[model samples]
Target chain A: MSNANAALAQAQSGAVQRYGFTLGCALLGLFLFTGCQSGGQTSDDKAAPVYEEGQSLTMEGTLIDTRCYPLNKDVNRGLDHERPEGFVKACATACANQGFPVAILRGGETDGEVWVLMTVPAVLADYMAEEIRVQGTVRSTGVLIPERVETFSDGEWLTVL
Target chain B: MKTIFSLMLAAFLFVGFTSEKTNQVTVKGKLIDTKCYGMMHDNHTNDHMVKKGDKMMKMPSCATACAGMGIPVGVLEDSKPGNDVHVVIAPAGTFAEHMDKEVRITGEAPYAGSIMPGKVEVKNDKGKWVEVEVAGMM
Candidate 1:
């Protein structure tokens, strides 16, 4: 045992059988990759947790306008019952002849800042692509008109989040 | 310098031993040109069931790439567990070099915005990779 200690005891038993065959092939390749990736992943790769129990949404607050000026439901809430002293110049001339823009998104604490209108592409007036998540439900519309805006019960200026 | 430091370590080991394959979307043909599950019905959601047309494409990750690749899968009905179809296997080679010919798969399209398009890889108009067999609908 003197040939450089028999080549350091055969390189320490060939590094313990190559580290026990690379730790038994990395624990049998991590148990065949978690039994073949639990039915091929998806749904956050099998973490699967998105319980949307029958709609039920209305968390927290902020969505108001009982006379707050931070609502821009695309302006104009100044109808003229035969103008009495030209109220605010007849709501700024019916918000510049019905192209209004002041603020609207009825029933939701409005003091400032909060947007939830997710999708609205019917009959168009701009509003598509919504899903701000965290308990969803958004419906508030107010449009002034002569052809379609009967306080929009179904005129659909798009706004049905 | 030592041959410009061994030619910059052989161009950094030839860009780290080259291995980056992209351009793999294979679909040649046959899995019964896909269209299964109540095969078309519901023009405006009138509902008779069996819904989904325009070439069905979706299924448990295409049945895990067609399990043991004897490749030929298209289901909207059978193998019920949670009905949501789309599966087109036989890509990325080795099912006997994609069995009976014609392959053109190009890759990169994992249901972009999800109207339902989990995977689609087929090519062959000189784009190569023409070995398809995934039709249960588009």
Candidate 2:
């Protein structure tokens, strides 16, 4: 009777140890994940810094073409380069995926407008030169059309320098 | 012992993550040179004719008349003489109220063909230089 009681006591202790080990592993994994990328929002995921309004006045970014390259030329007349069909949608999707918008600056020259863009403003639909530096970390919530035509379709519509 | 270990790990993570910083960028350039020059100039140059005429008339408004349409039109400001003033702007709405004037615009340097604007700087109503467009544009 004494031996059996001792055996039972030992088994209970063993079970407790195993449970605790499992719990410890789980807790450690949670801690590690908190600092990792796929985990919930952490300080690492903080958005880009914001810019002040009416600050030192110059900003730039890539010149995004809003035109979709159509397989058929008949519809291309009114399409031109500027007011293309899916330009808005492509930039929006790219912005969402990248977690930022594209920022660009326009020079004063009419013929040779330079497009030097900074990241984070990639998603915006419209921007002007002086306005770029003033507004920082502002994800422009504007219009974006269908997704299909904006991203993958390529027709060489607008040329950017 | 186990509690101490977990606490230590938590502390380490907090320190590392809290130190992370965000990015704010600064960009600068003149809009004088870009590939979309042709379209931006054309739209502003003959916007009146494009809106009023039944036919699509380009600058000089003579093309429409030569096409046998004799459409009444208004002349936008002539583009700057020197190539140095050549800058491209975006779609028609970028210039706000002043978008129609092709003669001499001193406002935001709009991206010519971009669906979105990269930067904006134009003369305000007070006549002082500002980065944004003052009036509502469609």
Candidate 3:
């Protein structure tokens, strides 16, 4: 073959090899990214932990009224909540007194999971908005049957119920 | 004899550790507000008391109102005052209108006192069980 033709063919072969290498790397990167995304459980997945019935769990979180928390996480995840009238704010204790479900805002996070307490709501009225530690059995449905509950007060943990 | 005893002990421990399986049960009872029942204990009626100004008065259909406001509703098994109360975890307003009605709930009993209901049926005036539509939780 002529010298110029041989050189042109050699250059074209190198370019093709480089393009193949780049495409292979891109496909591998895409596969790895998708694999990582599906490996971690999302918040909507119900079988995240696959908890057994009566499985014991101990968690620390803030006490919150379940009724209003879902309405407004920032406004109702505390001692006070916005009333249905849209013009009045009410205390969570009064709501709990009227038999609203009280739940624990896990890790005090507004975006975290809120597990409803299976115990008496009226008894928890006094401890609203406090940081609570609960030792209990958790249902697969995510409700907590609290066996022992304590509150963080004055730099110490005190048993409340 | 010693080997047999060791095997038996191991089997007992394995069964004890893994025996807490989820149980599906059907419970029949009257739906009651858990708050009132938990506080008063003896107040099992459908009507509850509310304070108006300085006086406490009976509020008719209070159980329905309370259940509508996201209060946990429980099933008083056999409609008895002192029987086992199984608290149901469901959508907020699912049991609002069914207060004080005879209900049959088929669900998973994660524990002794809590139910995750799959189907709930109430007895109509004609004495027939009718399934109620449950709202989907967000």
- The per-candidate TM-score of the B chain, in the order shown, comes to 0.24, 0.26, 0.76
Instruction: Please name the candidate that would achieve the greatest TM-score relative to the true structure.
Output: 3
Worst 10 residues of 1 chain B by lDDT: B109-118
Candidate 2 ranges beyond 4 A from true positions:
A35-42, A45-47, A65-161, B1-138
State the lDDT of candidate 3 residue by residue for A1-161, as single tens digits. Answer: 69999999999998877766665555555545544554553443645456564688899999987656755788888787766666334567875776656778889988776777866577888998889999987643356768899999899999998
lDDT of each residue in A1-161, candidate 1, tens digit only: 59999999999988977766665565555545554554364444456323231233433222221121222223322222122332243333332222211122323332222322121112112211111122342221121111111122243332323
Please give the range of 10 consecutive residues that has the lowest summed lDDT in model 3 chain A. A35-44
The model with the greatest DockQ is 3
Instruction: Assess every candidate by TM-score.
Output: 0.23, 0.25, 0.48
Chain A TM-score of model 2 comes to 0.32
By DockQ, the candidates rank as 3, 2, 1
lDDT of 1 by residue, B66-137 (tens): 222322222222223233222222221122222222322333322210111123333445755443443211
DockQ of each: 0.02, 0.04, 0.04
List the candidate numbers ranked by TM-score, top first.
3, 2, 1
Instruction: Give each model's whole-structure lDDT.
Output: 0.29, 0.32, 0.73
